[model samples]
Target chain A: MAKFKVLAAALGILLVLGAAAAQASGVITLEVEILPGFRISGPGSVSFGSLHPGIPEERELQLQVWSNVPWQLSANYYGTVEAPGIVEVQGRNGTWIELGSSTNLVIWDQPKTDPDGVVIKVPLRFTGSFSHDPGTYDIQIEFAVVPLL
Target chain B: MTRVILAMAVLLLVCCGQALASIAVAPVIIEADQVQAGQVFTVVCSHGGEEPLEVALSLALFDQDAWGRVILMEDEASVARAEEALSLERRRFLLQPGQSEAVQVQLAHADFQHLYAVLFLRPVRPGPSTRLAVLFLLSSGEGTPSLDLSGWEQRGTDLTITVENSGLCHGFWAGELLLFDGEGKLAEKVSVQSGVVLPGRSRGLQVSLPGWVQQVEVRSLQLGDGS
Candidate 1:
């Protein structure tokens, strides 16, 4: 009986040690990701206040960009509206600026460090010094963010 | 005596149950669409377990050899230390419980159209590791290769090992070789002649064996996209 008791206690100790070893080796692996993420939001559309023939108009819309890394923003206007005179939109995305038609303009772009929200004034201007047709110009501008990787 | 044994057995089972708990990684693959040079791809790694976790992050390549098997590329020193044109930030972190974190990876350069890279997340504590492969340029419209072993012929105590790669891009294969005698018993097991085969191309490897080789088998252990 004494011998049996000792053997059982030994088995019990072995079992406990084995369980502990297994526990020490158990690890949960989580998927990994790199840094630098951005959430571009605020102001769905850029709207001009009002327009007058032979008169220039300017309006500012707030475009906010939230970034996790160094980033730059660029914009391009689709040539959807075709009306008299010269219709060109001029503005700065954040710092880098391009002044032209059907061209992507680089606004305020350099590099970033953290995920912070920065708002920029996206201005729309229409210079109608020489008017050929007078009407409402419906334009669509697309915005994109480029991060320096 | 019987009671003591029964009690110990029950205690062991209870301990085993508690010891086996683990955390999980979601979307174990990072498949990017039409990625090119200087293109940035983002992936979100969500933690799914009862406890919060901390992990060490690293990169590796996963591949298979002549045999059909999935193996990590870093199992060997050559493939593990091979330089790649890749960039990433935040190498390690302590993730909050039940929270998903985002990681940004950029392909700085690619010698081939398609690239395969695995992001390894090893838990700081005891748990399983997640290997997520980022298949680059899959949107290049070309299909992945179907690598296989073909054309087995014997040459007087030697064997010709051939690998056929049928795809638009190249394939890398490496594994072990198993030799069997005429009696259908295992004879000798040797490391396979591993190498890269070009697309639509077949290459032969000559492996010398020790005795009369009645049967030969290949066990593909690693695989990856080759430039």
Candidate 2:
């Protein structure tokens, strides 16, 4: 009877130590890799077809942006515009801000995580006066997307 | 019947073309700490859409404004400095659908000062195209930085603190703010988001403060180890 009692106590201690050891090793560290993704796509051109004198012509272009991290979208013109015109981008509040010769920050630190991305509309307005030339006034605009850290 | 079939085929092609016209770039920001000369880094560019993409890579000096907006520097000296520090193996390349290209960038000079440059991947095709700007930050970790609280303002629940980096190297601000009431009692503790301040530049960090807070103090401010 004495031997049996000693054996029972030993087993109890062993079980307690085993449980403690198991609990210590049960902690898990989980990790996942999220590949950085940034993409942009839009139309090839915006045609403001045939301008008239003293009349304002407005055209809109839509751009799709996809990013997993914070991003900034900026626009700038490559060369001077012979015609008096202005380019504006639609803001979150539905307002438009003019884009200048220098880099203009259209969207700042906005993140779009969807795989399909989101579309943003940019509008360009120009009014040809009677004194202006009738020839084509090509204005080349460039759009750039940079990650904001 | 033949004409109808041809018209349908053309319409299908047009729809598919428009759907696949995107340019994708990965690892938008490349950072290195204690950088050494001749160290190489890689940036991958892929064409996610169906059309072939024509990409040209170039490096330019860049700086950030007080609000952290990136501004490309175009002065002669700035351009020359950027050109002397880094070089790319593949400046121009074409990527097909589902194909990617890795451009190798080798650092020629890693001075003690922090260097900021941008790799612009521009598309050759014209008319409203998208471009990707990848930022490279390199530091030798041999210089000390000076950070000072230049200004602060309160607007409703938001508290903006402007910090100036007057050192030769860039500094990162990451710490907590101790908000106290009018009686000098602790009101609330708020964490300030980490941001980079270039040398001789100031950056504004915005934090949320409790309405009853009267005084704000920076606590346990830790600067990054140039990493």
Candidate 3:
């Protein structure tokens, strides 16, 4: 009976040590500064000149985003526009989504592609209607890049 | 002659509109422990463009929705609470090309055990502009995190697991999903990316499974201190 008790105690100690080892290996410290740099750049303005009634005009703007961590891109317009227009951004899967007044996700969970940055071309289309007056109208769009924490 | 002049003016405007604005930030995520009054932290912001940039900094509280989308709090009460909790040394500044600034942030109140906020850096220029948002996670070091696997689902070869944190403090969880075959032998293993789960919130994480995977087991679930 004494020998059996000693064996059982030894087994319990081994199990406890094994569990501690596994937990230690799995715990990753969150304090490390892994992503130290993030950058985003684009043109100051895009001009779509002289829109004619019943005609749609298209222009492209290039944006570059660089980061050391996984990040997401979103865009939103500052004010409302009466004209019918669509702002489309190409994704990694070769698809485009319309960006509107509300914040819309353009790129989701994109990994770091380059050290400098990756250029993304955004196509803006404006369709004119006879109901709207002919004048110089400007709509400011803002792009935001945030790390996926 | 007037039409030709106007056309030349428009062409000149388009040619000069190629001004690019670039901004870079370091340490995108800031995690701290035991929040106290007058606690300080630093974030580095740099102007990577050719021209000068007028930068503005603001603070706002944020939360994650069911699909892991960050929603910035805009209500008056939430904004007031955030303002009362944190403050920046310089809210607006000017940065020249290749110039960097160290932003100083000070804590005023420790009203919650765990809090999340974002520091927004925006350029004061017109037209298409790009900005950056940095996340801050602060804790009082008083409570523990209780992470539980709420549920999971499989569709085709994709699997998603929902994890809920019902504790007083926030925590980051990570682990692996073990796949087995019909003979109960281990077929493959898929890693679960580490993500933060705020107090009283749940997060859905997607994992891809092999077609031959008949059984799945979540193993080595570990939670790290996110304060």
Give the number of the best model, judged by DockQ: 2
The per-candidate TM-score of the B chain, in the order shown, comes to: 0.48, 0.81, 0.86
- Candidate 3 chain B weakest ten by summed lDDT: B7-16
DockQ (model 2, Cα): 0.22
Clash counts for the predictions, in order: 28, 0, 1
The lowest-lDDT stretch of 10 consecutive residues in candidate 2 chain B is B7-16
Model 3 CA deviation exceeding 4 Å by range: A1-35, A52-58, A80-102, A125-132, B1-18
TM-score of each: 0.33, 0.77, 0.78
Angstrom error of the Cα, residue B5, model 3: value is 22
**Candidate 1 residue spans exceeding 4 A from truth:** A1-149, B1-21, B31-34, B75-83, B126-163, B166-227
All candidates in order of lDDT, best leading: 3, 2, 1
Clashing pairs for predicted structure model 2, backbone only: none
How many Å off is the CA of A80 in candidate 1?
64
Sorted on TM-score, best first, the list reads 3, 2, 1
What is the Å distance of residue A63 in model 2 from its true position? 1.9
The TM-score obtained by model 3 is: 0.78
Chain A TM-score of model 2 comes to 0.64
Instruction: Please state the error at residue B207 of candidate 1 in Å.
Output: 28
lDDT for model 3, on a 0 to 1 scale? 0.72
